[model samples]
Target: MLIKGYDDGPLVAGESLLPRPGFWSNYLMAICGNEPGASYVPEWFGDDGADADDLSEVLFDPERWPVFRAPAQGGPGVVVIYRNLLGDYGIDYLLTHPGRSHAQHVASWEGDLSGTGLSWDELIRIADTPATGEGVKDSAARLLLVLPLLTDPDLPDTAPARLTAALSEAGAPQDTASTTAEHLLAQLTRRSQHDPTWESPLSGA
Candidate 1:
């Protein structure tokens, strides 16, 4: 797909994984310590021969999405969502291998920033070369973690305002929250000088 706003950008060759609109929203909800809507409530499951009942355990019933996990380098693995069928989803807990696509152990993370023009490799290069943030990797990751929700058109509030509330909820002082939210939005604005696109923030940053 042209990926909407990226119409003037590169024509990438990968298809989007994770149920869009729902995926990142789910991730954002999880990070915000909220329930990820009944949508994530499994209608059925396929992981580890799990039945619908067992899915409660798979998703961490009591803790809920708050416990949604990801692995670190050389550490224990975590469950990742995947397509079970056209409209179905399942999770795979890689118990044996440490995650590597985004580098489980190191601070290194690589993934498409969707509408954003910046390549993760480019971000790393800038960071490593210095003089700039090369921008903070974790800062970028924080944006990515919530960009979908922040940018969501269906949201009742504007992106910047929504992010500010989110930051405040996460413990940033109101002033800090407002400034950081504006900074994040500014980062996206400055990043796409040509046409438009954007964040790669990590969870709970």
Candidate 2:
């Protein structure tokens, strides 16, 4: 039950609550901002609860793809595509087909990306450790957030290189290894924002 918002990542999750109207409004604003003269068209929603099949249909269909491809506004430039199903296909579909005539990337908090190859639970535990505190926690959380998006198998094994690269590019403070840990934790706690390219940045830092 993840409802990612354009204004902020993971607007809501782990609940059956409907997404706030303001969130949708923000998304609409972002779309219009990107395409100045684009007209608003009412989309056909499912009568029954939305399932993966319906969700997949929306993503795969050429007409509907534009809605999800809109660039994120008011935060990171990336678009926020909510996948209620949290399935592999949702992620794979975006990576496979990102629509056309746009240079924006869809950055999402996916999988687990803390430690060399730790599980989500393990990553959380590490982040929650008293010694880790906010800085390290935020770093660890962000890495975990990006874990699911990477196409790497044995994600735990190869994530460090990617994390280090992102940290360096973002000008993350301290040594590469420590900053990577901090970035991952920051993501889980919603203390940071990962750029469209997946570089986690500490907000207000």
Candidate 3:
């Protein structure tokens, strides 16, 4: 019989063995500092028999999202772009309390961002730009950077230009101007219905 966590069969008539967890076994791998190819299960999952309960805790835990601190003076932040149980890509974020270890959810693709002082359009703009020496600012930025690349490949070249313009027009006021030009390469490829003439950031393009 097949079980959720057991992929391998019994070793002997009375002896049983647990299947090793795969690279994609759980969401914690996305940020838990564990390398992807490791065969062992994460300690967070508990013993082999507790797999079900461990999974439940991972899915329901309020602090499940991984946190990344800013390099300079900014507070801690988290940017997670993960596939949900439904196999759809989703994004989430958290802002840490000043001088404290705790943080709170500030944004998600499916929820409100009113508390973040950022808008979806501004996020899309930032995602389009190439990473600076500072790197990506947050999880929302990372999601916007990747989502369009995975979109339908048949979109027209003009689509990205138009989308960029629209997003820019919709963007909120900022303290300073962005140095990079808006990214519309994915849109351009999709709209043109062809592969990029230049190299792509995605692997195996």
Candidate 4:
């Protein structure tokens, strides 16, 4: 007897069950491809020449950019850092899932530099801590380190401002933490264009 599978794997005599792929499995495969390549750019990272409106669509669309989870070993959740034209920063601890309709947001710090009151050394210290050790503190610290890099000096002064405003209007703060994360993620994605260092967080590094 012959058995058929979705992607065509080895055939076995006994009954074999093939579990359906999860939402992320298919989504990631389509965007990133079955094998890694230079062409793969995550949905979180807006396309080249994309404007604030384009970024807003990339960030706020849950179907496109779902919430990420930590490893089963227990580590820090995903952290996103964003900076506006006024030099304000936002740090968030994201608890979101692809299965959920909304994301949960826990703001560690939002608005203004003084709000966080963290020095560079302090911030680094926090980031250096293992994610599995100090979950919240580690995420916050990583965001702090990433915040400054999010701003691209060469970009127009209005870019960050426009993106921030657009994100706010897209129900970022009022909607869910996941939505707010998308806003910050948009900025990080933009920064990655100029600086490769900004790509680390997205890769779960």
Candidate 5:
């Protein structure tokens, strides 16, 4: 079967889903048998640059969808992050916000195997928890740690601003907590930029 990957972190390749006004409600009603409402919009499904199609349409009525010359699995899968407006805005807020919010946002996207259908508010809450276990910890630990220093609670800062600060600000406090925090922060920075939100403000710091 052809699989699609959607993410809400940032625009990146391999994303199949795109969240819009009412994507979640539609998806739930159509696939998961839940009806959050028909407020979810699948903006990426049309013949746009990303060329995303509704999974249900493809599955129920294959004739309407473009014909794939090769096998579905062999064909390229589209990976999309968050498509719902509420979800997207929530994530954006988390990414741009200061304090613990930045950390949780990074962790959610980092640990997200598939970026589609995520709730922005949930991600922000998760990011705040310093101890969310090893899996989530490894996912975006470095990104989360750098947030505290980079964020200026008084001044609204962009993700880049925070990241830049982290790069410049060196020599954090030397203590057990500090050392562990630094080590985890290092893991996120030293890795490659494959994920969607890596370039976002929260990811860098």
Candidate 6:
């Protein structure tokens, strides 16, 4: 899966007009899925200068998708961090956004494993919580951490008897896991929205 991995971090003016890591290897690492597959990035992305395709189409291409439009022409674009459903594989992709050296927006794509058929905003709308904005985001983050276990393919009888089981597998307590999962799912009830809550990691979880 070619997950968006571009970082919108401040780049020294006039650094390089390249993709996320400014290197091919790093870009490959970011876009490849559970296992690396042979792929050629379009030239417009500034990699090999190979034939290019409209980014939107490439992004929607079912072949490499579920994750990978790689080899994007670089400048400024949105970088979305994504991990595979199994959580073993992850990528940060820089999506090309013309004329914007920095991503106007950034967020995680959880791949809708919640199965409630609710959008992120809908989930948030239905939620009533004392959790702070950052706290909610943290809750959201923890839910994502346990989703893979809940949906694990190899789980024979049942992936997990309950959410707590999955949380325990993730080395998180039941209460903490439940809280975070609630926050993450809160917004999914409503339409997905761009509202983001960001904080310094130093603030501690």
Report the C-alpha lDDT of model 5 over 1-205, residue by residue, as the tens digit.
1212222222322112212222222222222112233232232111222222444333223122211111012111111122223323211112222232211222222222222222222223333343421112221223332232221212223333332332223222222223333332333223322444423232323
Q: For each candidate, what TM-score against the reference?
A: 0.27, 0.23, 0.25, 0.24, 0.19, 0.21
TM-score of 1: 0.27
For candidate 6, lDDT tens digit of each residue in 125-191?
Answer: 2222223221112222233222221221122232123333433343444544454333322323122
- Model 2 CA deviation exceeding 4 Å by range: 1-78, 81-153, 156-158, 176-205
Candidates' C-alpha lDDT:
0.31, 0.30, 0.31, 0.30, 0.26, 0.27
For residue 14, what is the lDDT in candidate 6? 14
Q: How close is candidate 6 to the true structure, as a TM-score?
A: 0.21
Please give the distance, in angstroms, between residue 10's alpha carbon in candidate 4 and its true position after superposition: 39
Highest-TM-score candidate? 1
Clashes of 1: 19
Off by more than 4 A, model 4: 1-47, 51-55, 62-114, 133-205
Residue 202 displacement in candidate 4 (angstroms): 26
Better of 1 and 4 by lDDT: 1
Q: Cα-based RMSD of the predictions, in order?
A: 18.0, 18.5, 19.0, 19.0, 19.3, 18.4
lDDT of 3: 0.31
- Candidate with better lDDT, 4 vs 6: 4
